[model samples]
Target: MKKIFVLDTNVLLHDPQAIFAFDDNEVIIPAVVLEEIDSKKRLADELGRNARSVSRLLDKMRGEGQLHEGIPLPKGGVLKVELNHKSFIRLQEMFGDVTNDNRILAVALNYRLEQEDLAASGTVTAAREVILVSKDVLVRIKADVLGVQAQDYLSDRIIMSSDIYSGYVTLFVHPAVIDEFYTYRYLAVEALQLPVQLNPNEFVILRDEMGSSKSALLRVSMDGGKLEPLYLSNDAVWGITARNAQQRMALELLLNDDIPLVTLNGKAGTGKTLLALAAGLMKVEDEHKYKKLLIARPVVPMGKDIGYLPGEKDEKLRPWMQPIYDNLEFLFDTKKSGDIDKILMGLGSIQVEALTYIRGRSIPGQFIIIDEAQNLTKHEVKTIVSRVGEGSKIVLMGDPEQIDHPYLDSISNGLTHIVERFKGESISGHMTLEKGERSKLAQLAADLL
Candidate 1:
């Protein structure tokens, strides 16, 4: 049976290429959905970008064929811009008002009735399955009340929440493997009994099979041919040490100039941002491996209109970037409160800016840290990644369970998507920090409160 998939405006705004996702099926775009997209095409956010893309795609399709009748999609599906189904008399009698959502529901209801009529008259050869695709929860709920099939648009998701990659695995090995790993610092990949293929730079904890509580933190070689011991640092960064095993793994990836991309995820006080900043400072300031250290995060919980602040652009960003500044101050170990500002000015190798200015520039020989990256969409993350120039490293760190985006969640956010998509590659590494090392109170709050 051939199914008709109706796309909601939110689905198009979530992903502009959603029209062609259906395989060999009929795609329907309600006329009112276009109106909604038109109203949102002028904004300056990701939504605006997607809306314009959808508009351009529709206009290009019009040149190929008449959309009112039906146009052939490149993926063997038919795309139709539904007009003249705006009559909401049937819906108003049941669901009350005819808002944009209700109007879309009315179009879907009309499609169901038309299909049923064709089936009854033998005009249709088989049963037709009509489904409404939307990203809005309320729209899906309303669709269910009206006896319509609806589902969320998940074209960008690479994994389920429970199946998300954790970048590390535990193996029960012989006690002498730990002894050999400590003596020679490298173990052959085939020496251990494994269940799956290991990615480059993936961390592993080898425990004793005799249950003697013996373990070692080791990393898979970039060639996936051997397991190498972690380069445990004796000196701490600004009096901060890697308190847990995951933090040690994150530091290993961050400090390696060969790895161009790294991702870290953890809840509050897991030392993700703090550790990344520390490693970035070590690379840019001490070793001189990079020209500068640039840090940027999206301005969430408050939209990007900076007019209400009292001072200039930097001053406007002061409040939003204070958490970053606090970490820098802690790393620099300032005696007085105002001395950290002088240190930052003296170094001249650090830049703390907003994510808005990162779109159109080529950044080479720099270490870029994007904090709170889970709030970003997959497309936004792509834009940020494509701007990386030669000899540069980008670390994306965020807590997916703490996302603030209205349309994103733990499984669909860019942070999780990148972790899943870049797992087996040589240029990327990931770690999920489980412990909170800020303070006893903070750790207790993370666990109990």
Candidate 2:
């Protein structure tokens, strides 16, 4: 049966292409949603960009026909603006308010009643299902209380956290295979002839199938034709050594110039940021592989924002970039208070940027790191990654389960989306650090609290 989907303002803001996602089902936009989108079109952020994109799309579609009467979507469904359904009599009795959310609910409620009336009077064979689509939890609950079917938009969600790719797998092989890998330093993938294909640059632990203690830690070749040894398997970068097998794998990918994109995800105290910073410094200062080290992160606050911070751009970003500075300080071993600033000034190649100013700029011949990427949306991530010019490597690291964005969750955030999307590509590699090396107390808190 053909369904009718009423869109909330947040659904469009989260993903502007949501109109075409319903597959031939009628899509309705409440007039109140337009008001809300218009109010956000002037801000200089991702939300403003999305609001403008949606407005332009709707304006372009207006050439086809009147929106209120209904217009034909490129898909085989009708798109309409709900202008005449402002009645709130049914809602005033249950919840007396005329807020934008209530107004949107009124539009959906009116549509459901109209469909039912038509079906009962024999004007239609049956009533089409009316579903209110939103990204807000409270709105969905209120909709349920009003007897309206509410659903979350799931077009961009990739997978649950438990099902995410860990980037490393244990493979049981014959004792001789492990011995050959150890002796020759490489083993052909054809020798395994396994059931499933391995992704390029995937880490593998080949254990002896005979239950012997012999094991070899190797990484798959970019071409997936052979298993090769980790180049920096035992090397320390910027005075930081890998404390675990997963951390070693992370460093292997991070220090490799062949791979252009790397993603790392783990709980707090897992050394994700620390390892990334170490490798970045090594690439920029030691190897001179890249011209500079550029680090940027989404500015989503953990709790209520302090609001309108004083000082220049760098000072304003100090609070958010403190974690980055802490890692850099540890790597440089700065004891004095002003030592980090002097070291950064002497290097002349390290730059810290807010993600807000990253758009419309092409970054080339640099090592870019985006931390706390879980707060970003799919569109925002694409925008940032697309700005990577030639000879540049980008690393995105964040714990998917620790997202701070109001509209994004573990499955729908940009970090997890990119991890799943890029896992199969030869130019990209990922690792999920399991153990926490920050401190015993910190690890315990992460696991328990």
Candidate 3:
């Protein structure tokens, strides 16, 4: 049975096309949602882009039919704008104030109550059910309190967002088994009984019984204890090399097209963003696998303020994107920082974008790198990913352990959530780089602090 999905304004901002994501289901856009979208349309960021997109989409649908009644969607669904004033009355009475969020919730509550009344009267309505879908946690909780069937938008369900795998696991194998793999080069599971927590392409260093001089690099295989070559490839772009085994695994995952979604976690100076940018440049500049190299990172600060940088838009962005520029300079072997700017200017194919402006744009055949993904909420990440057109690969890299957002942490951060949710899927892979290749001092500091 087709259900009535009442969309909240936050859901549309999280994904402008979310109205069409539900197959054949009737989508109801509350009248208050339009007011919310109109208010956000003036902002010059991702939110503004989404608000504009929703406005344009509604306009286009109006050409076909009236939105107040219902319009036929191209994807075989009914879309309607709910203008029920009864909901506004109910909302004003319940909440005592006409806040934007409360108004949206009121629309949902009215629809649910009407449905329940119809059901109680023994009338078999075609509307399967009324579900209030939102990206805001607070909104969903509010809906539940009002006795409505509220749910979070599943398009952003990357899972617990907490409890994401850190990609490093220490397995205590038998001393004799570690000895045999060193000499034989491959250890069969029959020979050594290890646990089942291992994954393919995962690296393990076999330690001796005494925990000294027994460290040997080994790759886990699908067929139980079968060990293979370390398989670190040297075909990396931008002259960047993996500083550690976990980095090697991360590089492999980033370069592999089969893995569309990759999540890299590490502390500062671990080179997660640098390696991803290098790989993207190589694929776009040399391999011609992609048409463009597009880099975007959240505008969150890391330990300092970016107060009042002088210049134009690009100059203002430069301060925020300096780390990316530094990596590009290192990759292009440019002697001076300005030389990297010249190279980027000369090659118009590469673009360094701010995550705030990625909404409502369809990026195709491009290698897109999203840095500092840990600062993004799950809703923000969904908004970015949904804009990916055909033949595009997006790599989300961040240090989950170093989130700066007050509302987000390791588990709730977008990067960690994507990694944990997409793990073991054929189209996605992840790696956590443990070894710090920045410097001896950096490594010691990371370990000690």
Q: How do the predictions measure up, each by TM-score?
A: 0.93, 0.93, 0.59
Candidate 3 all-Cα RMSD:
7.9
Model 3 is weakest, by summed lDDT over 10 consecutive residues, at 299-308
In the predicted model 3, the residue pairs found to clash are: 161-411, 162-411
Q: What stretches of model 1 exceed 4 Å from their correct place?
A: 84-87, 93-97, 119-126, 301-304, 335-338, 444-449
**Candidate models: Cα lDDT each:** 0.88, 0.90, 0.76
> Which 10 residues in a row give candidate 2 its minimum summed lDDT?
298-307
Better of 2 and 3 by TM-score: 2
Order the candidate numbers by TM-score, best to worst.
2, 1, 3
Q: For candidate 2, lDDT tens digit of each residue in 178-292?
A: 8888899998888789766789999999888899999999999999999999887476788999999999999999999999999999999999999999999999999999999
Model 3 spans > 4 angstroms off: 23-25, 38-44, 59-64, 72-77, 124-129, 158-177, 186-201, 205-216, 220-226, 229-263, 266-297, 300-370, 375-396, 400-429, 433-449
Clash count for each candidate, listed in order shown: 0, 0, 2
User: In model 1, which range of ten residues has the least summed lDDT?
Assistant: 300-309
